[model samples]
Target: MTQAQPSATPEFRRVAQRLRDDVTGGVYAPGQRLPAAAELAERLGTNRSVTERAVRLAAAEGLLTTRKGSGAFVARILKRIPRRAAALLGVPEGSEADGTREAVEAELRDMGLASRYFPTMSTERAPQDLAGLLGVKRSGKNVLVWETRVFAVPIGAQPTDPGTPVELIRTYLPLDIAAGTTLEQTDVTPLDIRGRLAELGHRPTEFTETIEVRPPLDDEAQFLGLDTDNRVVQLTHSTTAGDRTVEISVSVFPAHLWSFSYRWTAS
Candidate 1:
């Protein structure tokens, strides 16, 4: 296809990048079946084994999916969605326009894809590691944990994918601020937690987030419909009010399905 690449790059990696880039570059559409292995190898000036390895490599990164009977196809998922860094100087009254992350559903709708949220709630204590991150004391009846699976469909998708979730949101909150509230029992959203916390006099003055990428855990892999080999983006977020940390959330995004963007403003 393109001109020869640097030989320093492994042949397989170069082939893999070309396959991934071609998908993103629209040479192959999402859910579109790729040409046969022989054809692909011929186009790339390689043999079938190298082409197969490249496909597997790209699939592990979530760029494509392979079927036993059917051929490899570009992943039947949203390949591009902006995951902007959040800036929460203060919780806005009625909207999240204060530079904080916008809702995923809104982002999908803007991109013209239908989306849904499936949530599960729980009452629990923060683990030692998470307790340290949240800066919350573990003693007493004070931890609330919940997770939501966000599902969205790409336009003109195929039967291979239906109601598949691209991301999972898990959150932890100190019960002291939300002790006797709906958030304690019902499925709640990140923004909803922010609004409720602000109502209880815990408006955020600063937010902190860190990202890591690795292979998905067993359950995470199954729940998000990803192959165990796929890379996943883990986002750890915290909201602080003055000196108090009221909320912490970790979002798991399948790397094959989404990409993130960051913005900075001079203060």
Candidate 2:
């Protein structure tokens, strides 16, 4: 039998969309306090609870901010220019697998933009999708998951306000390849995983990347400072040595902050 379709849209989603339209159309100015929950409910002819939930949804999208004992206010949005970056379809001659990140940083530096990499590493069972990518069974096998956030360096800003985050990256490595190595460490490292893998005699001989466009998840939206109406570019990197898949990384870039290009030559 065919699977049934999911349920209809929630009432809060409808309310949220209406509010988003108003905000985009300038009905609500940035930094202006939004109407009270009861007032909004009355205006939309909906219950107060539904209106509150809708406000929360808009807040999650970075379009509104709600203050305790006060009320919701429209957010002052910033427009960030998209930076151009290339994703090579194949490994360029004389280039190592680990050079991509460094290249990106160098390009930004040339444009008077600095970058910092913040990484968090943890040991966990490989998710089913990641297991398949790593050519392993989905039997709750433990693996090393590394999450990294790339942020622009503010010239004279304090650490509390570092700069805008440019991208979010997550890498998965099989236990056999990660155990007893720095890759499994919780501390952030300047060395790339390819360098660590080379030390372990598993240098990848091939690399492939797949790119997709999709809307961000709630957490991703918050991390990238994106609204619900915004989208992101998701790229997957797969590196292999002979028959073994050594690493798989997924990166998410806010659509407004990244522009990708590549050249192709016919055989």
Q: For each candidate in the order shown, give its overall lDDT on alpha carbons.
A: 0.75, 0.72
Q: What would the per-residue lDDT of candidate 1 be over residues 1-267, giving only the tens digit for each residue?
A: 687644335887778788778877889887899999999999887888888888877777777877779988887664477666554454464333354445555677687676666778777778777886666677754578878887787555564657557788888887666668867756576657777777777777777788999889998988876776788899888777778777888899888678777666668
How well does model 1 score by local distance difference test?
0.75
Off by over 4 Å in 1: 1-28, 33-47, 67-71, 93-99, 103-106, 133-141, 154-161, 185-187
Residue 202, model 2, lDDT: 78
- Point out where model 2 deviates above 4 Å: 1-98, 186-191, 264-267
lDDT of 2 at 105: 70
Candidate 1: lDDT of 253? 87
Work out candidate 1's RMSD over C-alphas: 5.1
Clashing pairs in 1: none
Tens-digit per-residue lDDT, 1-267, candidate 2? 966432124666677788888876799886789988888998867789878777877775566766679888876542343333344445543344536676667667665667778998887788777787787667665778888988886455477765667789888889877888877766634346776776677766788878999999999977876766678889888888778888888889876556665545565
